[model samples]
Target: MTFFLQNFFNGIMLGGLYALIAVGYSMVYGILRLINFAHGDVMMMGVYFAYYSAVVFSLNPILSFTVAVLGAAALGFLIDRVAYKPLRKAPRISALITAIGVSFFLENLAVVIFGAIPKSFLDVFKDKSILEKTITVADARIPLLTFLVIIVTFAMFSVLFFVVYKTKIGMAMRAIAADIPTTSLMGVNVDNVIGFTFALGSALAAAGGIMWAMRFPNVHPYMGFVPGLKAFIAAVFGGIGSISGAVLGGILLGMIEIFLAAYFPSVMGYRDAFAFIILITVLLVKPSGLLGKKAIEKV
Candidate 1:
């Protein structure tokens, strides 16, 4: 039971990260119906931005993390304006290809600038209360970081929930989601609403990237690739375009991967494949996901 608790705790920690990243995927898909392949790269940029802000500028780590998240928010808006906005009227295929192109561009651009080597971000986790403290569960000691992740995630969810359903801006976003043309006709600035959605999603991704790097203690140009893809899979599992679904899916996926690796030591090497396998199962079993609403097409 203690062993199960330990692995479960680890899975929750990982799920927090996955849920944040999955939010970005769900938001973009909900708005544009286009998967921003570059979303993960945006997270990578945030990691580096925070890294340099701490190491080069010698700023406080917390302050650097804030700057990194803000920078990533700005980057999200920039990507939409520069790459996606132009193709707004273009075919969905065009936007998808462009998203892919942007993904590669960010990855290659990072390689040119930051090189292929991974940088250490151990200091980001050092000297922090959350990192230093641990609580004993029977015989197992659980890191405070796990609880920190959960607390932060729920806090973020609250904020996002309010922003999406309560605010006037959120109303506009929902309006756009319902029908962009109708929303535009209602005098809502579709562009601005979309931009804000991107910004919000990107900010969350940045936060996830920072947390991920702090836990993993390394940053590389391609670091966000796997997490991004896995998060995307999580989004799908939870039902793409559904916010709550994304979170639920991410948590379940994380738990599955962690527990699978823990209980099935022989298949540990194939842990990554488990996400896709689950994705396939979900696609076959329940395409709309656990909480997703099935769409009705008028014939």
Candidate 2:
């Protein structure tokens, strides 16, 4: 029972990170219907940015995270301007391929620049009171980090919820999501909205990446690979275009992976398999995911 509780806590903490990354996927899909394959690499870039800021600039973790998020937002803006904007009117297949190409380019670029060496971000976890502490409940001990994750997730979502549903930009974003041509006809700046979407998504991905690096402490050029895939799965699992759905899916995925790793020792060796399995299972059982609404075709 204690073991189970421990694993459960671990899963929740992991879920927080997944939720962070997953929201980005859901947001972009909600607005643009594009997967933004490069989203994960954006997170990787955040880690690198934080690393450099910490080591080179001698900044503390908080300042480093701020710089990383800002850098990611800028990078995301550039990606939208260069790779995706021109293909906006083209077949979505073109945009999808471009997204894939962009993803490849960023990953390879990281390799070229940072090399294959994995960087250690041990200092991120040094401060126990901030985001890592231990508490007991019903034979289960939860870490302070778990609580911090819960707090951060709720805070982030609350802000996002308000921004997407209540603000003027939110209305414009939804308008674009429903029909870009119509939204454009209404004199909305579709390009700017798209750029904002990328920036917001990238910012969330950056936060998730830093938190994840803190938890795992080891980051490589390809570190974003699995997290990116899992986050994508989370977005789809809940509902690709649904913000709440993405968060729900991410948390659930985190829990499932944690349990699978704990109870099924053999599966640990092939951790990535769990993501594929869950993705397939969700598709087969409930295609729309837990919080996702079914998309209706107008054709």
Candidate 3:
């Protein structure tokens, strides 16, 4: 029972990070029907930004995190403006290839500057004081960080829900997702909305990247690769284009992966295998996703 609890918490914590990235993917797909493949790399850049700000400029961790998120948002905006915007009316494949190119470009850029060596945050700032001690409830000892991750995940979702459901921008975003042509005809600034979508998604990914760095204690140019894949899977599993579904999928995927890693040592070598399996299973059983609505083709 304790083992189960421990694994469960671990999964939820891991899910928080995945959900953050997944939200970005789903949001972009929802709005533009385009997968921003560069998003994961955007997350990679965020961690680097936080790391550089903290280690070199001696900034506070909170400030460092803030700067990382803002920096990512700005970068996201730039990417959309420079790469995606001009190709809006081009072939879908063209935009997708461009996204892939952007992803590779940012990753190689990081390699050139940060090198291939994996770096850790030098000074522990935020979340550093989380007690190392674990409380044994029954046979299981639960770590403080586990609880903190769960709380943070929930809080983030609550805020996200409010912003999406209650705000005017959120309404506009949803309208655009439902029908871009109609929304544009209705006088909505489709381009600006799309840019904002990228910025918001990238910002969330940045936050997740920093929190993930805290948990894993390592950052590399390619670190985002696996996590990015898992998050994308999670987004699809829950329901691509559905905010609630993304969150749900992320948490569920996290739990499953952590449990497998914890209980199955040998299988842990294939840590991401379960994510792909889940993606396939979800697609076969419910292609629209666990929480996604069936998309109808308009003739």
Best by TM-score: 1
- Highest lDDT, which number? 1
- Residue 141, model 2, lDDT: 75
lDDT of 1 by residue, 96-135 (tens): 9998999899999999998888888865544656655789
Better of 1 and 2 by TM-score: 1
Tell me, what's the RMSD of every candidate?
1.5, 2.0, 2.1
Positional deviation of residue 294's Cα in model 3 after best superposition, in angstroms? 0.8
TM-score of each: 0.95, 0.93, 0.92
Better candidate by TM-score, 2 or 3: 2
Error of 3 at 293 (Å): 0.5
TM-score of 1: 0.95
Error of 3 at 257 (Å): 2.0
Clashing pairs in 1: none
For model 1, the superposed segments whose C-alpha errors exceed 4 Å read 125-132
lDDT of 2 by residue, 156-246 (tens): 7887888899999999988988889899999999999989889888988888898788777788888998899999998988888888888
